[model samples]
Target: MSDASRHLDARSWKALRDKSPEEVADFSTHLSQPCEVCEAFLERSDEDDAFGVESLADEALGSMSTPREDAVGWARLRRRLWTPRRAWLAGAVAVAAAAVVAIAVLPPVASKEHEDRSWRLKGVAPMSLELSAVARLPDGTLHAVTEDDLLPPEAVVLVRYRASEVSDAMLVLESPEGPAQMLGGYTLEAGTHDLKEAGELAGVSLAGEHGPRVLVLAAWPRGPRSAAARDAALTQRLVPEEAAQARLRLRVEPGYVAP
Candidate 1:
């Protein structure tokens, strides 16, 4: 549970000790605060002598905001009343702290790792139906698709939305070579690429496509071969087939294309 989940104070714990059995049960069940101390007091059950219990209460109340480990002392006191196992003191505290850390910290690390793993050379596949297709053209014209200037800079292609649309497309790369350098236009440097290599880099899922999808990793500007020759050469010569999959319509010519 989070610190935000509950707030237990000295008054709350005192009330539990003084209350009847039914009241104690209600308090325990309704307690959103740390219940270990209150529970321990209840376990002692003989409230007639307030000496030891009162002092413990005062100490516990003072340390409410202290580190959880210190707080564990009161929790231990509560546990001792019910389960007299002398062996579990160290282990249970460790488990509770670990649980807290896992809940509070592990999720963000996993999320970032997942996000970083998403972008690479692999093509985007459709994951759901919400992503609607805006346009489709024959394979011949596919290589000549216009760059959606309005889309975000990272957007290499636009699936369905008009010329420029915000993209959710993700890339994953796999070949021993790094990201296929963008030469220019729909042309690419010739190289071998495959599902095994690219897939290992990362995976992307479009809104509709269910299984693995293809991606166009590179392209060149339309012109005489000599005009954009360097970019065209890199796009056609160096970029690997496995690197760019022409699975979806690109808003811009990726300069590199699959052979």
Candidate 2:
């Protein structure tokens, strides 16, 4: 989870929502912790959180004596969240935008190796749908593991959603030569799916000469070849076979996938 999502819980959300967007920055610095409450808040049915966020935003907009846009990014966020066809506006937008608001005025931050691996902890994906790195253990069990997690030498890479609700999923693996289609015309119906098992494995191997690689997963109302997402970037114009696609990028470390 991002630093912002980890700390923001229901109480905090209400408190922050009551404040003007500009005041949100004051709450940002203290959001660093493993927060199950916030995770549950996000895990709730889509409509529940959406209504809460929108209601708060509506109230905020109503109370601001200042110009609406001048209230800060919240106003724009409110508009974006309510747009029809955006099913993911709840967890992704709320957590991400709130986090950014909290940290906007902060000083330059430093990076560390731990942060790279821990990105999966956010329990959220960056796209309208959800996508995360998955791997199989030596015992043949599957887990929603991230690149930061240790994988055995022979572990196979896979992808799955944050929840079963997000649908019409697709995947593409980027190579130095170009993009390789993994499972373009498919939708994930359940938990972890081995990339090799879900699609044709002919000549496909993340452990092959490519060394380590990047896995791109998309889940939207669209297919492998069409455009369904409002964000142009989410639309995979490159692949034009199935429906529209929105993507989240995940890295598989070279060493982890090495032979």
* lDDT per residue as tens, model 1, 1-259: 2233333345544655566565466655656466675456556655444437557987899988855555557556645642321111221111111111000000011233334432222223221111111211213221222322211111222221111111222222222234432312322212321111111211122222222222333222222332243343354444322121232322222332323
Residue lDDT tens for model 2, 139-165: 645445544354544455444334233
Number of the top-ranking candidate, with lDDT as the measure: 2
Give per-candidate clash totals.
46, 12
User: Each model's TM-score, in the order given?
Assistant: 0.13, 0.31
What is the RMSD, in Å, between candidate 2 and the native fold over all Cα? 25.3
Give lDDT for model 2: 0.39
